[model samples]
Every structure is written in structure tokens, then in C-alpha cells.
Target: MMSILKADLLKVKRKWFWLLVFLGPFGVIALQLVNYGVRYDYLMQQEPDVWAGLLDNINMFVAPALLLGMTILASQIAAIEHQQSSWKQLLSLPVQRGYVFLSKLAVAAIMIFISSTLLFIGTVFFGIGLHFGLDIPFLAVIKNSYYPFFAGIPILCLQVWLSVVMQNQAFPLAAGVFGAVFSMTAAFAAPDWIPWKWPLLVGEHDPIWYAVAGMITGSVILIAGLMDFVRREVLT
Candidate 1:
């Protein structure tokens, strides 16, 4: 598993992986800048508490940007193998299929995790720049920012699974877009059972439960994806 992960890292060493990591968070922040720029006074009036308003603005865009990032990251990582038909070579190796699948999944999660961290950073940087004061809502920042990540694990797993299982990259990427849209809709109205909306469901009631559910569901889906991968035959 360690060796496989090492190889995956090296494989992405020269790719535009870092750009994907930053794009989602930066995009979200930029949108907020335009939003707040145009209506700084009006938005502040909406919240009475400017810090809360700033955080609210930041959180509003975090989930969608995160889902979109996961979609692209999954396709890009899987494309590394699909484009060159390298899956056959990978599976042909002595390593178990689970390790290969797990390593790839971990890389997918890590990329999104880094993107989430950047989301937090961008939020804080701009919040300060706006003179929201030094007394920032640090806990709210961490929870709202990172909570979406925990809830997003299952989506990351699904995205990776689809990208790996489908022969055409477009299918998996499109599935991701569909899921993202569903999640956005689910955000406004849907039960928690809809795994598509988990990212938005976080902290709606009990954050701990949401986090736990994400971990359990994501693990199951990942293992299921690996088992499926092992059962199927990769074509040359």
C-alpha cells in the first residue's frame, strides 16, 4: 500500500494536480469578494454581526465548490491510467487490487482535503482584509470549512469508483456533475439518506453523527468499489 501510494504521488508530481487543489477554494473566495465588494454594507446589515455575515457568505459557496473539485480531481487522477491504458499494467503487478484502489482513493481525498484547507485560508485572509476585526470566529471557520470535507468523503469515494470503473472518462466526470447538482438541490430539500447531500447535511443537527456516518459510508463504498474492481477483468 505504501509503495502504491508512493508511486501515485510520483505519477502526479508533474501533473497540474496543485492547480486543481487551489482552484475550488480560490474560486469560492473570488465569488465572495465580488459579493461582499458590491454589498459590503448591505451584507453587514443582514447579519448585524459582521464576522458572522462574512463566515456565512464563505460557507454558502464552500460545499458546491468542494463537490466540483472532487469531480475534477477524481477524473484527473483516474485519467492518468485511463488515457494510457495503464490499468492493465497496474493490475498485472504483484500488488493486490485493494491497495491500488485504496491508494488512488486516498490521493483523491487528499487533494480535496488540501483544497478545503485552502478554503479556510482564503476565508480568513479576506475576512481580515475586509476589516471584520481580529476577533474572528475561528471555531466556526474550522467547523463550517472542514465539516463539508468530512461529509464529502462519500462523494469522493463515489467519484473515484466511477472514474476507475468506467472506461470513458466523460461518464465518471458527468456523474460527478450530476451528483453535485443533486447535492445542491438536496441542500434545500432532502432527507439525510440521500448520500448526495451529506456535505450540506453536516452540522444541521449533530455534527459528530454526520462525521461518523460519512466515515462509515465512505469506507463501505470504497471497499465495495475495490471488490468490484477485483472481480472485473481489465481489458488491454
Candidate 2:
């Protein structure tokens, strides 16, 4: 598994995969920078809690960005195999088919984790730069940066599963885009069980519950996807 994972990493080293991971958080922070830059005084004056307001603004895009990123990451990873006609070659190896699927999933998850970490650091620095306060709200910052990622586990798994099973990347990519759009509207009319709504639920009174549910639901989806993957005949 470790060897397979290492090979997967090497496969994309020259593809600027890490750069994409970095861009996810960087893009989020950059947008906030522009937002705060334009109305620094106005926002600061209007916001009762500077850090809270900044976090709220940042949260607005995090879920959609995360969903889109995950979709692309998953689709790109699977596309490598499809484009190269490497699925049969990969499955013919001594390793279990499940390991290959798990390795792909791990790579996507690790990339998202790195992106989330960058988001945490970027948020702290971005907030400090804005002079929100010398006494930073570290807990709030952590939640704003990571809670959504945690809550997005189902979307990540679903994207990966869709990417891996379907040879056509368009389906997975479309699902991701639709999920991103759904996340934005979820707060108003979406049900609590909708996975797309989980990420944006960070502002809810019991946000942790949604995160936990996403993970549990994601685990089930992962298992089901793996079963189908393991049983499928690789023609290519």
C-alpha cells in the first residue's frame, strides 16, 4: 500500500499537483484579502466582532471551494489512469484492488488535508494582517478553516468514488459543481441530512454533529464504492 501510494505521488510530482493544493487555500485567502482590502474601514466599523466577521466572510466560500477542489482532484487522479490506459496494468499487480482504490482515496484526502492546513495558517496570518485583533481567536480560526473540510468528507468520498468508477470524468466533475452550488443554497432550504450542507453547517449551533455525520456517511459510501470497484472487470 505504501509503495502504491508512493508511486501515485511520483506519478503527479511533475504535474504541479502540490501547486493546485496550495492554490485552494491561497485562493480563499486571496479573495478575503480583496474583500477586506476594498472595504477595510467600512467592514471593521460595521462588524461588532472583527475576528468573527472575518471568519464569517471566509466561511462563505470555503465549502464551495473545497467541493470544487475535491472534485477536480479526484477527477484528475482518475483521469491519469484513464488517459494512460493504466487501470488494467494497475489492477494486474500483486496488490489487492481495494488497496489501489484506497491509495487513490488517500492521495485525494491528503491533498485536501494539506490544503486545509494551509487554510488554517493563512487565515491566522490574514486575520492578523488585517489588524482584527492582537488577541486572536485561535479556536474560531481553527473551526472556520477545518470544520468545513471535516464536514466535507462525504463530498470528497463521493467525488472520488464517482471519478474512479466512471471512465468519463465529466460526470464526477458535474456532480462536484452541482454540489458546490447546492452548498450555497443549502442554508436556506436544504435539509439537515444533505451532505452538501454539512460544510456550511460550521455556523450552526451544533456544527460538530454535522462533521461527525459526514464522516460516518462517508465511510459507508467508501465501503460501498470499494466493493463495486473490487468486483468490476478491468477491460482497459
Candidate 3:
């Protein structure tokens, strides 16, 4: 499994996969930069707790970015296999099929985890620069930055499953796009069972509950996808 993961990591090195990871968090911060840039005075005056306000603003876009990022990351990873017709070659080796599936999932999740860390660092630095004060709410920032990723585990699993099973990347890509769009309104309209709503902790349940639920749900999806992937014939 380690060897498989190392090889998969090598395949993606010097590739656009890294760029997407970097961009995911940077894009979120860049947009916030412009937002505060335009109304620095008004925003500062309107909000008593600027850090909270900034985090709130940043969190608003995090869910959509996360959904879209996972979609593209999964598609790109799967594309490498599909485009090169390498699945059969890789699967023919002595490794279990489950390892291959899990390795790919690990790569995607690692990238997303890095993106979340970047968001935390970026938010802290950006908040400091904005003069939001030295008394930062470390807990709040952590929640805003990391909670969504934890809450998004199911999405990562589902997107990867979709990408791996379908030879046609368009279908998986389309589902991802739709998921991103749905996530924006999910807090208002989606039910608790909707996976898209988990990231934002829609319905206002305990924040930690969303993260816990995401892991449990993600595991089920991941296992189901794995079983199907192992059993399904690869004709191409």
C-alpha cells in the first residue's frame, strides 16, 4: 500500500494537481482581499468583532470551493488512469484492488487537508494584516478553517467514487459542479441527511456532530464504492 501510494504521489508530482490545491485556499483569500479592500472602512465600522466577521465571510465561500476542488481533484486523478489506460496495468500487480482505491482516496484527502491548513494560516495572517487585533479567537478560526474539511469527508469519498467508476469524466464533473451549486443554498433548503449540507453543518446542529457524521457517512460510501470497484470488470 505504501509503495502504491508513493507511485501515485509521483505520478501527480509536477502536475496541475498541486496547483489546484494551492489555488483552492488562495482563491478564497484573494476574494476576501478584494472584499475588504473595497469597503475596509465600512466593514471595520459595521462589525464590532472584525475577526469574526472576516471568518464568517471567508466561511461563506469555503463550502463551494471545497466541493468544486474535490470534484476536480478526483476527476483529474481518475483521468490519469483513464487517459493512459493504466487501470488494468496497475491492477494486474500483486496489490489488492482495495489498496489502489484507498490510495487514490488518500491522495485527494491529503490535498484537501493541506488546503484547509493553508486557509487557517492565510486567515490568521490576513486577519492580522487587516488589524483585526492581536487577540485572535484561535478556537473560532480553527473551527472556521478546519471544521468544514472534516465535515466534507463524505463529499471527498463520493466524488472520488464517482470519478473512479465512470469512464466518462463529464458525468462526474457535472455532478461535482451541481454539488457545488447546491451547497450554497443547502443551509437554507437542504435537509440534514443531504451530504452537501454536512460541510456547512446545515440545520444548525452541533458543529462537531457534522464532522462526526461526515466520517461515518464517508466510511459507508467509501466501502460501498470499493466493493463495487473491485467487483466491476474493467473492459477498457
Candidate No. with top lDDT: 3
Off by over 4 Å in 3: none
Clash total of candidate 3: 0
lDDT by residue (tens digit), candidate 1, 1-236:
99999999899989998887888888889998899889977898799888777776776677677888888888888888988888999999999888988898988888888888888888889989998889888888887778888878888888898888886888888888887777767867778777777777443667556666878898898888888988988833
* Clashing residue pairs for model 1: none
The digit string of per-residue lDDT tens for model 3 on 1-66 reads 999999889999979899999999999999999999998888888888888789878988999999
**Candidates by TM-score, descending order:** 3, 2, 1
Worst 10 residues of 3 by lDDT: 198-207
How does candidate 3 fare on TM-score? 0.96
Shift in Å, residue 8, candidate 1? 0.8
Cα lDDT tens digits, model 2, 137-180, are 89888877788888899888889899998888888999899999
In Å, residue 82's CA in model 2 sits off its true spot by 0.5
TM-score of each: 0.94, 0.96, 0.96
Give the Cα lDDT of each candidate: 0.82, 0.88, 0.90
